[model samples]
Target chain A: MLELIVISTLNGVLFGMLLFLLSSGLTVIFSMMGVLNFAHASFYMLGAFFGFQLTKWIGFWPALVLAPLLVGAIGMAVERYGLRNTHKHGHVAELLLTFGLAFAIEEIVSMIWGKSPLDYRVPALLDFPAFTIFSTNYPAYKIFMLAISVVIFVALLLVLKRTRVGLIVQAALTHPHMVGHLGHNVGRVFMVVFGVGSALAGLAGVIAGPALVTQSDMAASLGPILFVVIVFGGLGSLPGAFIASLVIGLVQTFAVALDGSLASAFGPLDPSTGPSVLTDIWNVTIAQVAPIVPYMLLVLILIVRPMGLMGTRES
Target chain B: MRKLTLAIAVIAPMLGHAASAEDTIKIGYIDPLSGGGASVGEGGLKTFQYLADELNAKGGILGHKIEIVPLDNKTNPQESLVQAQKAIDAGVHYITQGNGSSVGAALSDFVTKNNTRNPGKEVLYFNYAAVDPSLTNEKCSYWHFRWDASSDIKMEALTNYMKDTASIKKVYLINQDYSFGQSVRTDARKMLGAKRPDIQIVGDELHPLLKVTDFSPYIAKIKASGADSVVTGNWGQDFALLLKAAADAGLKVNWYTYYAGGAGGPTAIKQTGLDQQVFQITEGFANSGNKAAMDYEKAFRAKVNLSLWYPRAVNEMRMFKAAAEKANSIDPVKVAAALEDLKFEVLDGGTGIMRKDDHQFLQPIYISSFGKLTESEPFDEESTGWGWHLVSRIDTPQAMVSTTCKMTRP
Candidate 1:
């Protein structure tokens, strides 16, 4: 039982960190621009596909440097041409534009790379087992993913707290009028933040691509789940996002880890003796019920703590 | 300048002659080229290309070079109809596709309706990989030729295997929550109930297609249910992901996957390290050592610059070629008639005999296992690992049961 919990918790943390790498950028962009970038996950998909191509051409190290840079440039272009034009039409318009961008990007990805999961293998350097927990060897690639995510998170925090551009960005996020009066280029700040956020998503994609499956539809699959995380965390709170990401991740991981039927909790009702419904529902498994954990958590959180943990305001 | 003018003068008559020859027989290749099903569809298209090239190289079919009009369905049923209509408009006599069962059902209905509208220009539909039994059984059309086994037939084989292995007492049924999954689950339940009444169905879980990321919960449920075996009919990345997650969670039990042995077989094997795992029922394709299978794979890989893993697509192309040859002409009606009467040996060493009763090809199925990779010489270098493992080939008689359709033969 302890072993299961330990393994599940570790897996949850690893996955939560990945979600944070994606959500952090999204939250920052949302905080600054007040426009939810629906195409964020698409950039992540681009990162994975681009990384795969780069790795094949040059190597993993070069791919690690170049893929996110390419995605960042693409993100900048989308912002400059697509999102900026739609910004005048309110947040809804911006959201709709991003949604269209997502659709177009997915089609473009399919066209260029084809609609198949790329055989994206983890680099040979990080191919060995990191460590054994409960007699199961966890791969070094997962550990690398966890490390990169943590480093990014810390670096982001330091930049926000200590750096000049970060300070101006923070000021713009909180007091836009004051930052403008101070003669700071708030538009440039917004663009830079969006670019960084998008690059972060791309980085996550590059790291997670091989671990997960790298395909055209990978972004679409993750998009909704990421939305759920951001919403559950609160609209613009990074800490809240972090907590919610971990909570959602753990809920799912732990749900899968724990093995028991709902019937077992209420005592073993004999199928032949019990009602037809009870009999029909006999031998139901916990894994079967795992996917419902996040939705259940979302509902419970909305009801009990509308603001969410560490969140400033209700969504 | 004189040489250029002379070159154009020489090419002009040849181009005119080529254009005249191309106007004879037009065939449509409808498959998903840009969506989730592109890998399989693209492969099918490549095989079609190979057959077209081969046929044209061999002095064309009946003194007319075959012109294949390719259309991308993008894996959408609605899009498939448009593509089918486009093919029809482009004067394609014969059309072949049906990557997904839903797509096939939609296309089949459209073709049937079109045939009624234009009785003279009826297009022949050759389905490659839509395994819904309704296509051949309830929805059997005169213009349609199903080239793969139905879900019911596949489940029969699977349940029979389970019944033979009496050690599998409690079973958990899980599949993608869609038409294909529902069909497999229903048929499997009926077959299991009829054959092995003693085997208890502990759990039945349905996950949405391409949505499930973590399968640990499902694995836990299977473990808690005390299921001695797990049965699924999931295809592509979903199957590979689920199997890997299950294996990682130490849900060590017999897992019988219907579509796991095709394109995603090697990935699943490598992911789970299930080299010693027994009893997997893969669809018939490249496993059967025959000229058609080898030649199709070689040609397809060369043309597409990708591996030929999806065997059903390859078989579909081979079936199309056979039908065209049998007809001795590219006329839709003639080809349809020929397909209904086809009893030629396919590249897979299986006798691909399309029954006049239902138009379902009675192809051979192989039951293989993941064996130790050997450094054996003379084997193709491209073919290595457990993917090249040998197991007993379940001949056509053992693989498929007889169908009961009383239709007029060609």
Candidate 2:
């Protein structure tokens, strides 16, 4: 029991760190622009695919830097040429634009990647087991994922707190009109934030490609969960995204790890009696509900605390 | 007078066709031609086209030229229904589909309903690869004929092999949380329990269908369970991602799967370097040691630029042709009637019977694994150089399990 708990906690933390990497960017973009980037996960997917392509030529290390940069630049172009045009149309239009862009990007990805998973493998350097807990070997790639996520988190904080660009961006986020009145070029700041946010997502994708199989529908698959993380973490709050990511990740991982059955809990409840809702409920085990835990939390959070765990506003 | 003219306009085409009956027999090939299932669906389309060409070269089926009408469903059930309706509107009475069982179930139900409502315009749904089991069992229809082995049939063959393999003692069950996945889990547990009562069931886990991005947490549970083997019915990315996670975690366990050779599966398997540890049960694989099958695959690869993932597509096509010839008619009703209890030579040198009970095809099912190519092996998946070698061959007698199909014939 102790070993299972230890392993499950570690695995949860590792998974949470990756989720933070994905949701942090989303939260930042949301906080600054107040336009939820539905294509954020799609950009992450593009990062992985681009990283795979770049790795084919220059290898993994260079691809890690280059792929995210490419994705960030693409995100910036979309913001400048695409989203900017639709900005006057209201939040609904922007959301719809990003949603449509997500589908379009997925289609383009399918066209190029052939609707099959790329053999985007983890680097041989990080392929070995980091350590084994009670005979369960944790892969070094996962550890690297955790370390990179932490580094990004720390770097993001330091840059935002101590840098002049950070203060300008922060001020612009709160009062874009005022920042522009003070001659801070708020548009450029928004564009840069969008780029950096997208870059963060891309970096997450680059590292996550091998860990999670990089397929065409990858964006669609992980995109919803990333939204859940941000929403649950309190939309637009980086710290909230961090906490929510861990909460969801840990909830899901620990849920799967749990072997509790309703039958066991209720003392030999037979389900063969047929056609009863209670019977149906009794038949379900914790493992079966693990995937829905995040969404369930989202629902509970919205119902109880609309502002979210650390959120200032109801989004 | 206007109503008469409208009726005449609708009747004009039928009258024109009656005067000079169509020369070509159209088979509406409904499958995912785009989106996630595109690779597999496109491959099926190519095979069907190839088979049409092959049939046409030999004077077509019953003196009519074979025309394959390809429709893209985008792997959605509602879209498949729309495509099916369009195919029916195009005067097609023969349609085939595969890929997703959910889509298959929808198409089958739709075809059955359509056939019941419109007698002469009834379409025969020849399923090439959707193997949900219930489609043939409780939900069986006379209008539907499944050419591929159902999930339960495949699982039976798989568990039968596991029962004999002494290395498999502690087994785990992990499947996508859906109707098909549920069926796989239920059948596996029942079959394994019956086969090897001594084998301990370590863990049974069901995650959301196709929604799992990472399988590490599931793998962690599997590791904790101390399972020596895994039985899963995950296809597409689910299957590939599961194996990738297992490989990354360095989990040394035998995998008995239904679709470990799906698109991108070979890449994952190769990355893992599992060699012969992973096993898959299918009607036929890329290299099953038959010269004719090998030649067919070579021509198919050269033409389609994809490994023949679905050998049953060839089987289904060939059987359709044979049934048409036997019936001496291109009418779907006549062909479907002729297809019942029909036995024909399969691609890999074996006879397959279209069982009258459930309209299910029973053929020699091969259990294969990725390993070093033997002298007889001809092709590999995704140019991996590591072809799937035949591990065990379950003959028709063993694979032909009883079904609960009470199909009402028209």
Candidate 3:
């Protein structure tokens, strides 16, 4: 029991931290620009692919630095040409354009990389086991991931909170006219903010690609849960994103550790009875439905706290 | 619609006559041609197309030029039915599918109902890889033929092997929560209990199929349970991610799997450095030391840039040609009759029988490990530098199980 608790908590926090890393960029874009970048996940995919390609050419360490820059540049270009063109048509048009861009990026990646998983791996330097907890030797690479996430979170908070560029970006969000009147180049501010957000997503992809399967469809898999994290975190709140990522991660982890089902309360259901909704619900162990727990949390949080666990906006 | 049917009936003979002159024997390749399962589906398409070309190069299948009609079902059973309809509309007499058993079962039923309703235009379903045992048991159809060993048969063989190995004292079961995975777990439990009663089952987990991106939590549970071995039916990404999580946690345990040799599987095992620890039970693998199979695998990989995922697909296609030649007809009814109890030489140099009882192909199943290749093991998977080393081979008799299928033949 002690082992289960210790290990589950560790795994949960690690997973949660990874989730925050993935969602931070999406959260920033959603809040700063008030334009939900639907292609954010695509940029994340591009980050991973670029990381893999750059890693092959240079090294993982160098690729880690270059991949996000490359992805951010791509994001900046997309913002300039793709999103900007659609911006005048309203927010829906921009969203739809990003949506189409996501598909286009996926296709391009598929054409280039093919539909198979690339052999992205952790560097040999950080391959050894970091520590042992109840006989489970946690890899040093995971610890490295945790440290990176923490560093990014702290750095992002510091920059957004205490910096001139950050001040101007924040001012431009709500008072674009005034910022423009003050000669701040509101368009360029939005463009830079968008690029930084895309860069953050790319950084995440670089870290995550080696840990997770780096494939063309990597974004499609992680895209939905990212939205869940941001929404549950209170849609534009960084701290809310952090807390929500941890909560959802821990909940999912602990849920999978639990074997308990309603069967203990209501007798064992017969398999011969065949598949039905009642039997499925009654017989399903917590561990079996672990994936759905986050969505359930999303629904519950939406109902109880419509704005989110921490958010300024009600919607 | 009636007039259309009557018009088709009148024109069909002329179409058939014209077809006899230059008409190709079209086998509709229906599976996920696009979307998440596209990689697998595309590989299947290539293998079938390769087999068709191989047969065509050798005077074709009874002088009828072979052609594979690729239909994208997108891994949806409903869409598979739509594709099946399209295939039939285009005069395709046979179709093969294998990615998901749900799609396979759906196609089987559709073929059976269609065959019953439209007697002259019967479609035969050649199942190459969907291993859900239910497809061969109560759900078996006369119009359907399975070329792969069912999940239960595999579990039976796997547990039989485990029964002799005393090192595996505690076992954990993890599989995707679906018909195929459910059957794998159920069969593993039953077979292990019956075969090796001393072995304790520490944990059994069924997660959503292909939904889990992270498996660290599950690894924690397995760690807590202190299981020395895990039996899983997880394939593709599920299998890959599980190995990834296990590697991260440094959980050292034997992975007894159904598809540890799938696409990206060998790479995962190699990356995790779990050399010779990941065991897979399958019909055949790339490096089975069978000279013919090795040669074929080399040529196949060279031409298609894909591993021969399904030796069963080869058997399915080869046997299709053999049966048609024997029947001396391209008619589905005749071909189905010839296929029943047709014992043919497997691609891996063994005899596999397409049993008339349930149309389940009973062949020698191999349990192999993905690890460092020896000098003898020439073929390595996905350029992983580690090949499948043959551990044991369970002959057809030992791997065979009774089927409750009572076929209603036309």
The model with the greatest TM-score is 3
How would you encode candidate 2's per-residue C-alpha lDDT over B126-226 as one tens digit per residue?
99888899899888899899988999999888887888999888999999888789889999999999999999999888888877766778898888789
What is candidate 3's lDDT per residue for B1-410, written digit by digit as tens? 99999999999999887877556889999988767888888888999999999998998887898889999999999999999999999989999999999999899999999999997888899999888888988998989999989999999889889999989999999999999999998998998999889999999999998889889999988888889999999998999999999988889999999988877788899899999999999988988989999999999989998889889888888899899989999888999999999999898877889899999999998999889989988888888888899999888888899999988878
Q: Which one wins on lDDT?
A: 3
lDDT of 2 at B381: 82
Worst 10 residues of 3 chain B by lDDT: B15-24
DockQ of 1: 0.28
Kindly indicate the candidate among 2 and 3 with the higher DockQ: 3
Model 1 error, position B188 (Å)? 3.5
Evaluation by TM-score, superior candidate among 1 and 3: 3
Error at B182, model 2, angstroms: 1.8
Pairs that collide in candidate 3 are none
Clashing pairs in 2: none
lDDT per residue for candidate 3 within A254-315, as digits (tens), equals 99999999987778888798879988789889999999899999999899999999999885
RMSD of each: 5.3, 4.8, 5.0
Order of models, best DockQ first: 3, 2, 1
